[model samples]
Each structure stands twice: as C-alpha cells, then as structure tokens.
Target: MPSLELDRYLGTWYQLAAVPQFFNLVCARDTMATYALDPQGNVSVRNRCTTWMGTPNEISGTATVNDRVTGAQLHVSFPGVPTQESLEGPTNYIVTALGDDYSWALVTDPSRLSGFVLSRTPALNEAQWQQIRTAIEAAGQSQCMYLTSPTTGGLSGIAPLCTV
Candidate 1:
C-alpha cells in the first residue's frame, strides 16, 4: 500500500461504485464523502448521498490511522453505525489504491468484503474505469461485485461496471 497523504486526500469524493452495504442502501444517487483534518490529529469524515425518497442522507464520523507507517489503513466509525466490522473494533477503512494526483481512489477493508470506487468527479472515462478495475483486481477483489453509483447530475445514466 502506498503511503496516503492525508492532506492531499482531504476533500469531497464522489462515489462512482461501491460494494453493497446496509448503511448505504438508503442512497439512491449522488453519493459522496468529504474528509478534513480534526483537532486531535485524526481525520473527520462526512459522507452524503441522495436518498431514494429524494431527500438527503448524511453521516459524520472520525477516522483514526491504524497503520501509521503507510497511513493507508484506518478505522472509521459513525454514530449508530455498526462497529462489529472487525474483532479489534472500528470499521476498517483502507486506501487500497490511489491515483498519484489524488484524483481517484479505491477504498476497502482488510476482508475486502466492502469496497468503494471514489473520484474527484462523478464520472469517469473508459480508460479510467479500466484502470480502476485493474487496481481492484491487483488488490484481490472482483470488479463484478461493484455496482455503479447512479448520479442525477454529471455524466448521468451510466451502466454498472459489472456489465463491462
């Protein structure tokens, strides 16, 4: 894992695709996440999305560095969200892959059970999508498990990666 620069990674990232999760089931489109530096030297996480009911759904949490050496591994927790994601507690949030320019990233846990494809923009070109798939495969994950996150704006009405 490459050492993640928290400073460069701090910003809003559009969710291009993600492995299904109960917490995000409420989201129908326009899913995004923002990160910022917190006073305690940790990171603050704010995830937002458009609900199926046409309303907004958001969650705020904290992400603590789990692997200081790499700064690629973290544990994020939101209020009322499940914490049983790991035996050591806290939901594992790892930056398995990242673009050098910090324009895109692939986030997952140690188990690779849940994964997210995040980008600076809501849409990605074919080459970018292919590169993301390659990165996911290198991380030992099947791209077939991912579903394209629908967006009302941006590129709009894109087919899921699973079909590609």
Candidate 2:
C-alpha cells in the first residue's frame, strides 16, 4: 500500500526468490531484472537468468503505469507472447512492498499467484530477508512455501528454500 517514487525504482534488481513461473523454470541462478523509463513514459523491463544448463536466458517487456497517484501498480506485457485473459487490463502487477531506500521490493499480481523478491544485490542481510518474508506474508502469501530462493552464488547466509 506504499507509494513508490518512479525515479528511484528504475535500475537493476537481482531476483532473490520468486513463486516459480513456467517461463523461468529453467533458471537456476543469477536471476536479475532491469527497469528503465522509456521516452514515452512507459517502463522497459529486461530480465535475465542463468539456466540450469548454464546458459544465459533473457526476456524483454514493457510496463505501463496504471495508477499515478500511488505509483504502485502497473501492467506488464512481453511482445510476441499471448496476453492472459485475466491480466489483460491496466494493472496486473503491484508493488506490495518496497524498501525505504528503494534497495529492495516485493511485487505481485492481482491474484497473488506470482510473487518476486528483488534487491539491488544478489544477497540480502538477515534483517532485510526477514522484512521481505514478513511483507510476503502480509500480502496474503505463503512466504515459506512459495518463495523459492535462487542460487545466485552468494546466498550462503540465506536458506535455499523459504522454509526458514
């Protein structure tokens, strides 16, 4: 429910964990996303990950702000991919939680079927991780069961799974 400053939110973000998506099933490590404001005022999204086979995979998309008042909701669409009937609207993604410094963020869809824990770095401190977990639970999600920690080569301090 917190409003986000669009300018501060645009940058590279490493995916610490996520509710597994079919398209990202092959991702094994080094998952990341980058956001940039386009000339037309839309947000450009670029996501990349190291596949299980050690290959780098990537996808590009665009996001349109649906609510300027809150700056917390948007609709993201990837070209060449069929839009799901349920997500064919102005707002499909919402920033449910964001760090004070914009160093991290928790994003989810209207249905809460997909969730992502993103940060400026591949690793997060214990306190930050706890904060994200709490936010995930506050958003009506199962933090332990749903969030799957990625092996980004620096998560030794964090549990591989969200069980902790």
Give the number of the best model, judged by lDDT.
1
Tens digits of lDDT, candidate 2, 6-117 = 8999999988888877877877788898999988888888989887798999988888888878989999888776773322366878999998888889999999998888
lDDT of 1 by residue, 39-145 (tens): 98888889999998999999888888888799989888777766632323544899999876788899999999999999998777787888899999998998888
Local distance difference test scores for all models: 0.84, 0.81
TM-score for each model:
0.91, 0.89
Pairs that collide, model 2: none
Query: Residue 59's C-alpha lDDT in candidate 1?
Result: 88
- Model 1 lDDT at residue 38: 92
Off by over 4 Å in 2: 84-88, 151-153, 156-161
Model 1 scores worst on lDDT over the 10 consecutive residues at 82-91
- lDDT for predicted candidate 2 compared with the true structure: 0.81
